[model samples]
Target chain A: MQDLVKKMATELDLKGEVCPYTFVKTKLKLEELESGEELVVTFDHAPAVENVPRSLKNEGHKIMGIEQKGDHLWKVRIRKA
Target chain B: MKLGILLTTSPENENTNTVIAISTAARKAGHEVSIFLMYDGVYNVNKKDFAELVDKGVNIAVCALNVEQRKVGRVEGILFGSQYDHACIAADVDRFISFG
Candidate 1:
């Protein structure tokens, strides 16, 4: 079971950031990772939950999962593609 | 992807925000991004956010004629070019986005 746990290459906490900046920072962080590496991004802005994933998908990245951590807070796991 | 952004509007317009957002995103994606500031867009040379864009590796050029007309003098770290430079940037990039 331990071996099955996927390791995250990096984490980006964009709690106070807004739309385009959130996505922009995420993309920049992703660029620093190797292919197949995973990035964990946390968002406090509601729109980023939808916008970030969509924008990443458009760029051909793979979204592993998205989970709500608290009220109006979400985390998205993405695999570089 | 190599992207060319042709900006003809000034910071007074919301289009300037769009340009910054798009250019930032493109640069973050490791894409080559170039911005040609023409007409009123040359006025954005002094904007604080414009400096951030330059720091992020977005190549920015201002039109010589427009800069002189506006008396913007010399802004550090920004290239001053002519229409020919804009044409060359358009020809060199894979796609050109115009914001007027």
Candidate 2:
């Protein structure tokens, strides 16, 4: 079998939150990432979908993917670029 | 020459003012700008009240999925789509800036 590569994952759970706070918490967590590292953020706000990825993209980070879990929950994958 | 702006919050909230400020500033800088709205941001373009920004050449785009989620149809000048609408703007623009 081929070797399996697992990237380091950091999850920031900010369920039941709002804007700016979600952005701020995610940013602080992202600050700890090295280039190429991955962060998985979970939040319940739809705005977080736009705000978090947009904020990260503006800061020169890469958005790997965004996944919506349930009615109010989402998972955003961001890579430090 | 082109600037991609994303507003992810509602204007009813004070937080939305930041997005407007940035868009206003970009216009003052003389760049062609368009704003894509998603989530609560779809509400920002629910009326013609922001006509000044439109007059300034800021095209408004709202996420289609978000519009349905929020049940806000019949809003003028706000198109419905996914983040791709916004991403395309970012792809073609000289710069992408987002405010929430």
Candidate 3:
């Protein structure tokens, strides 16, 4: 039903890094999110499979979606409770 | 609710670990987890070794079309035949998320 598609508008940005580090930083921010809150994380790394979403879930956060715009830029959305 | 995690990258890529991290976390939080592997991600299942977290029951749903295109052997457990579709994925979960 795409119910989670409803955008809630929260933003978090992680810069100047690569794998594991980008994910590590993103996890730190998710700790502060409340249920149904949305977070937008901007990252420069090319491989997102291992870090971003994983770290979010590790902290009990929900990753709404991820969009890659051009090369070297990605915007990941997360919802935390 | 159940969740669908899309993995479209290869194991060699840095993103593979991120996908694993997210899937493991989802399972730990008590959410049903399934992964759809596409593009380079089809190779993830081909790997013989995985992290320790994989031992703990992770649901993996692979993209059949992608698998056939790559002509990889159909592995058991971690990989599933394309008989399952995205409609199945969306219907089977509370959330459908992608990682590329």
Candidate 4:
């Protein structure tokens, strides 16, 4: 069996960006996409892994997935809503 | 939704970051945002990051009284308005967030 990969409409690498900014940049990118489009954002800030998803969800966006890619890095898949 | 952000503190305060963060997020969410800067918050009009907010299309207005008190002349990108403008912002927006 094989897991299906979700296609991302856009991607952001915020590896060195901090909290709020991690979410801030993600929010900005989401605005540039059409509704229902997907965005993949990678960041190393631990708090953002939690904060970004919460904030985005609050704004009515959908969180497709969150994966830990390394000791300090994580990736979030979001579908604009 | 239309959003109103009232900022009363200067950039020295941590809430300034909150102001920037929230306004940026609100703008990106396709909401119209108006930020009313009063008291020491007027000082933030010159900060580098604050300029980004203006560029992001957040309507920024500084209190005319505070601008005069601080001896700040007209700033290019910021609007100098009276308390009436602030009242209008409060009345117009569907949601308001305050950072002091």
What is the TM-score of each predicted model, taking all chains together?
Answer: 0.54, 0.53, 0.48, 0.54
Clashing residue pairs found in predicted model 2? B63-B81, B64-B80, B64-B81
**Candidate 3 RMSD to the correct structure:** 13.8
The list of candidate 3 runs beyond 4 A from truth reads A1-81, B48-54
Higher-DockQ candidate among 2 and 4? 2
Best by DockQ: 2
Give lDDT: candidate 3, residue A7: 48
What C-alpha lDDT do the candidate models reach, one value each?
0.82, 0.74, 0.66, 0.81
Recovery fraction of native interface contacts for candidate 1? 0.00
How well is each residue in A10-79 modelled by candidate 4, as lDDT tens digits?
8899988864467678888999999988899998866567657866886799998999999988999999
What are the runs in model 2 whose C-alpha is more than 4 Å off? A1-7, B1-49, B58-100
State residue A11's C-alpha deviation in candidate 2, in Å.
1.0
| Recovered native contacts, candidate 2 | 0.00
- Candidate 4 matches the true fold with a TM-score of 0.54
Report model 3's TM-score to 2 decimal places: 0.48
**lDDT for each residue of candidate 2 in A40-72, tens digit (9 for 90 to 100):** 899887756876687678778888889989998
lDDT of 1 by residue, B5-82 (tens): 999988999988999999998888999999999889999988899756888999888776577678886577777755
Question: In angstroms, how far off is A21's CA in candidate 4?
Answer: 40
Better of 2 and 3 by DockQ: 2
* DockQ class, candidate 3: incorrect
> What are the per-model DockQ values?
0.01, 0.04, 0.02, 0.01
